[model samples]
Target: GIKGAFRTRIAYVVQTNGGQFPYELRVSDYDGYNQFVVHRSPQPLMSPAWSPDGSKLAYVTFESGRSALVIQTLANGAVRQVASFPRHNGAPAFSPDGS
Candidate 1:
């Protein structure tokens, strides 16, 4: 069976220059190949976090015109916004049990 860190990919973010108007969150192999986008928005994205089992990602995005936390499931391209309030939301992390 696959074991250790190499068995899973890594997560990162890529930002374009001024006026590009959007940013992207990416996932790629640890060796820096097979890169692909996990999220994109015209506002901003920050605090990207990967699930303990590498099956999902939790991050902050300004897609709604305010900071909001979003969780994306890699297996089927499912996304759901969460932890949003009237002001700001960010710094998302998964519990040890992947809850």
Candidate 2:
């Protein structure tokens, strides 16, 4: 019951505009339909990885001028800033256990 709540479909971020200063993170079905924007930032998005069960996305972004790691839940569009350092933070990956 709880597990199925967020298991709608597979998701990944798509960037248009030639991956320039303005980029968009879009999520869609594995078949490239039912697409929607998960996040958008002026900076680039890097190191997007899915959780173990494929329900959440963990990614790195430069939206704050400095690199920061963010984890977003795909179901309700809830976002949390997980890692933010003084200078740099990038290349985020989720643990096998989804921690």
* Cα deviation of 62, candidate 2, in Å: 0.6
Per-model TM-score on C-alpha atoms: 0.84, 0.72
Error of 2 at 30 (Å): 3.1
Who wins the lDDT comparison? 1
lDDT of 2 by residue, 18-88 (tens): 54446777766666778888888777787777777777888888888889999999778788999998887
How much lDDT does each candidate structure score?
0.82, 0.75
Model 2 worst lDDT run, 10 consecutive residues: 1-10
Task: Write one digit per residue (lDDT tens) for candidate 1, span 4-96.
Answer: 333567787778776655598989998889999887768888988888778888999888888889999988979899778988786898887
Off by over 4 Å in 2: 1-15, 18-21
